[model samples]
Target: MTRLGYQVPNFTYPGVGSDGLFEAVAAQAVEAEESGFDTVLVMDHFYQLPMLGAPDNAMIECYTLLAALSQRTSRVRLSALVTGNTYRHPSLLAKTVTALDVVSGGRAQLGIGAGWFELEHDSLGFEFGTFTERFEKLEEALRIVIPMLRGERPSLEGTWYSVHEAINSPAPVGRIPVMIGGGGEKKTLRMVAQYADESNIICAPDEIPRKLAALDEHCERLGRDRSEITVTYQTSAVIAPTKEQAQAELDAAVAAIPELAARAGGVILGSPDEVRPIYERILASGVDGVTVNLPANGHVPGRVALLGETLAPVVNRS
Candidate 1:
């Protein structure tokens, strides 16, 4: 349901350290709300992701940061970009998001995915199962989570998780939209067609049409309305006042996080004028929403605001 979202996936920045990091994050959230971003998200990871920095870089727990963010700003929806399923029990995750909804006055969404960070699991003492096993666990977890979100106390005897009439008491004030992030055609898209209210995918700009078409086919096979699920692209962007400046910013970004340059998919770089057409093309492909990775420049004072001011209208128009 969110048309435009901003993600703060990193905490370490040029001048801000751990002592003032959360305050800086809170400031970005407030700025995002003021600048027309509909939702604010933090990455649900234990370590700083490889592209961003070393594992030991300052990474706060996701839900804790979201709870703190709820107090600092009003109106913007809050969520993790996608919570890794292996880290917590399904019932606990359901309760946590519900609590977030209650605290934020019903502005909460649950974005979840099959756990991917093996290193995080290994270090945190969670089971690092085979890919098939992880997806199996995610399937079972959703059965428990979706029912609880809808106010039903589901009893499930699943292979990975079992709950006997798990009650989510003091239920959330409203429905918390469930967003599943991933683009696996056979497994993930099938699950999205069956259970998710939204799907977030990362792909090359030109690959969007094919992905959306595949999702449509999945919906048709499941007898689900394609319109029922909002399709959002997860991307990274570079923006600046002028074309040359934007390119410079992007070069600096790619230089710092070489992964951005290596993996060109889902990374858009340019000034508003240049970036607008790419958004237009993607929106024309029928993407209903977007959530961007802005960690590289998001901590800078006006960077988030500038992004919102420049790109929000472009997205909204398309």
Candidate 2:
């Protein structure tokens, strides 16, 4: 379980061009590892998310970045916040994550979800199906992916995917925990109960209780123990050494990306003393852990470190 995780959702840092982009990313990962964060994640998308920036903004491939970060930092577990299932075949994904686990010396996890970014799909020539169709594909993909990750040769014939005695050699160095990301009551949470080792609920803090109840219901229907799966919450944060500085950062972020203003309530914004209780309240809502993406000033040196310092004690306390 990831008690505290840092996500790198933006790559367009000020003053750093393409030549120093990877190094900037690497520096944050190293800092997070040293600062008490147990996990580090990156978004899995070919193009920048519209809520964050223009389509032409710098965006690196997810797994390649993780594989590279694995060499740069050794302690923090690495994964995509969630890999879009429609982007790759199930067996191949299992193979890729298994290789990541090997290279990372058993510090790799597989975080995945049903594909959602239609613009990326349409631009990249990948099939962008209906919501129902995408969920169907995700279900079929999991059936094949789960067994393969456990070192079994799975044979499956389904509507969206098919595999016959699929082989995944050089099995993962250790168990590669499957983390499913989403909070939909019907399809997403049900799939999380049935297949995933971890469930990342993407909702506002006030909504976590309802989402957890939905997940509990699914676990009950499936006759699976609720404790079998770990639950985590996903949200954005903007923290500074002082309240005024934090507000300035938030204001700047909302100015640059107007969409963020609409979702400001879901974001944690303040200094360490101010935000610690916010996180405590979130953890009190019953999530086993939390993963935060620092979209406002994460690329700035020591920003991620400060976030980890503030959050690690709050989340990891016994």
Q: Per-residue alpha-carbon lDDT of model 2 for 220-266, expressed as tens digits?
A: 99998999899999978888998898888878877776656765666
TM-score of 2: 0.96
Q: How much lDDT does each candidate structure score? A: 0.85, 0.90
Model 2 sits at a Cα RMSD from the real structure of 1.4
Clashing pairs in 1: none
Predicted structure 2: lDDT: 0.90
Runs in model 1 lying further than 4 Å from the true structure:
247-266
* Superposition TM-score, candidate 1 onto the true structure: 0.94
lDDT of 1 by residue, 57-105 (tens): 7888999999999999999999998999999999999999999999899
**Pairs that collide, model 2:** none
lDDT of 2 at 201: 86
What count of clashes does model 1 give?
0
